[model samples]
Target: MVIRAEDVRRSYGETVALDGVSFSVEAGEVFALIGPNGAGKTTLIRALTGTTDAEGTVELFGAPPTDVARHRIGLLPQEFSPAGRLTARELVAYYAGLYDESRDVDAVLSDVGLEDSAGTWYENLSGGQKRRACVGTALVNDPELLVLDEPTTGIDPTGRRDLWRLVERLADGGTTVLLTTHYMEEAEELADRVGLLADGRLVTLGSPGELVARHGGDSRLVVEAEDEMAASRALESAGYDLLPDERHVAVPVGPEEIPAVVEMLEAADVEYGGLVWRQPSLDDVYVALTGTDVTAGGDPIEGGRP
Candidate 1:
C-alpha cells in the first residue's frame, strides 16, 4: 500500500472531526474520499499529510508523513491563495525550485491547459483559470502521491472536463492520487475506489462499481394511477414500500416484474401517465449509505444533515 491509515482520530475541542477512521490506498491508483461537507474528509487528509496531529497510524510509502515525505507529495489544498503579483510561470518556477527533481515549468503548465495563461498574473485570471494554475503548481514537482482537495470547486464545466483529463493522465503514469471532490461525475469517472465519510466516521469504502452494485437497486417504478390511494394500497399489498410522494408508487423490481406490473395495471384499468425506470447511480448509493441527499447542503465543506 502506498498510503494507509489505521484507527485515525482527531478532535477540535468539543467537536470530533474524525472518529476511528481507517483505509488504505494502493500504488498507481486513484482513491477518492467522498462525503458531505464537514464529514472529516479535510481533517483526514490533513492527518495523512502530517499537517494536523491526530491519534492514529498514517504511513506514506512505508514511512511516517514528514517534511521529506511532503516533498514527494503534491498537495492542492481546498483553499489556495497565490501571490497576485506573480505571473503563472513565476509561481510554478517558485514551487519547482522547492523540489529536488523538478518538472519543466512550461510542461506542467501545458499539461494543465495553462500554457496560454503562462504570462497572466495570478490576480488577473478568472476563478477557473486560477484553479488551473494552482493545479499546474501542484504538478510541478512530479510528486509520487497527489492529494487534491476540491480541485474542481471553482472551475467551469469545460475546465472541469480538462482537469479530469489531467487526473486520468496522472493516474495512468503510476501516480497514487487521493482526491476529495463534491462532483459526483468526477468521482465516477476517475476513482478506482471511493470512501464515504459521515459524522466523523468512515462510513463505507469500495470501488465505484462495487459500491453501486452493493447498494444500487433496479429501476424505480413510479405509477401515477387514477385512484392514487388504491394504487398505493395495491403496491403495498404486493410488497412495495410507500415513498413520501402520495401520487407516486415505487417498487424495487427487476425486468420480470415490469411485465407483471404492466399486466396488473392493464387488468385493473388504472389510469396512469407513465412509468420511469432509472439505473441506480452513485447519488443513490450516497443517499442509501448516509441517509442524506448529497445536494442538501450549504458550502462544499459544510455537508448536509445526518
Candidate 2:
C-alpha cells in the first residue's frame, strides 16, 4: 500500500474533526475523498501528510508519514500562498531546487498546462493559471505519491477538464494519488475508489460504479410542467408512480416506460415544459447516505432522506 490509516482520530478542543477514520490507497491507484465543508477532509489530509499530529497510525510506504523521505512525496494543500511577484517558471524552479533530483522545470510546467503562462507573474495570473502553476510545483519532484486537496477550486470547466486528463496521465505513469474534492463529478471521473466522509466518519467506500449501483436509487424521468398538480394527477391516474414537487414531477421508470408516459400525458392534455431522463450518479449516492443534497455550487442543503 502506498498509503494506510488505522483508526485515525483528531479533535480541536471539544470539537472532533476525525473520528476513527481508516482506509488504504494502493500504488498507482487514484483514491478520492469527498465530503461536505467542515467534514474534516483537511484534517485528514494534514494527518496523512504529517503536517499535523493525530491519534492513530498513518503510514506512507510502510513508514510513518513524517519518517518517509520528503523527496518521495508531493503535496498541494487546499490553501497554498506562493510569492506573488515571482513568475510561474521561477516559482516552479524554486520548488524543484528543494530536492536533490527533480524533473525539468519546463517539463513540469508543460504537464500542468502552464507553458503559455510560464513567464506570467503569480500576482497577475488568472485564478486557473495560478492554480495550474501550484500544481506544477508539486509535480517538479516527480514523487511516487501525490496528494492534492481541492486542486481545481478556482479553475474553469475547460481548465478542470484539462487537469482531469493530466491526473489520468499521472496515474497511468504509476504514481499514487490521494485527493480531496468537492465536485462529485470529479470524484466519479478520476477515482479508482472513493471514500465518503460525513461528520468525521467514513460513511461509504467503493468504486463510483459500485456505490451508484448499491445506493443511487432508480433512474427517473423528470417532467417540468405548466401545472404540477394536474400533471401529478394525470400521471397517477395512468398508474405511474409520481414524485412531485412544486414545479416538476419525477417518475421512476426504465427506458421502455418513457413512451407510455408521454402518451398518457398527451391523452390527458397535460402541458409540460420538457422531459429529462437522468441516471443515478455520485451526487445521488451522497444524498442517499448523508440526508443532505449538495447544490451546484457544492454547498450542502440539509434535507430528509428519500
**Alpha carbon lDDT of each predicted model:** 0.83, 0.89
lDDT of 1 by residue, 204-257 (tens): 899989988998555577776768777777777666776552246767666667
Off by over 4 Å in 1: 221-276, 297-306
lDDT (Cα) of model 1: 0.83
Each candidate structure's count of clashing pairs: 2, 0
lDDT tens string, model 2, 1-306? Answer: 999999999877677788999999999999999987767788899999998889989999999998999989999988898999999999999999999999999999998888888999999999999999999988999999999998899999999999999999999999999999879999999999999988788999999999999999889999888988898899888888885331379988988889999999999999999988889999889888887654422212111001
After TM-score superposition, the amount by which residue 287's alpha carbon in candidate 2 deviates from its true location, in angstroms, is: 0.5
Cα RMSD (angstroms) for every candidate in the order listed: 3.9, 4.3
**TM-score per model over all chains:** 0.84, 0.94
Which 10 consecutive residues of model 1 have the lowest summed lDDT?
297-306
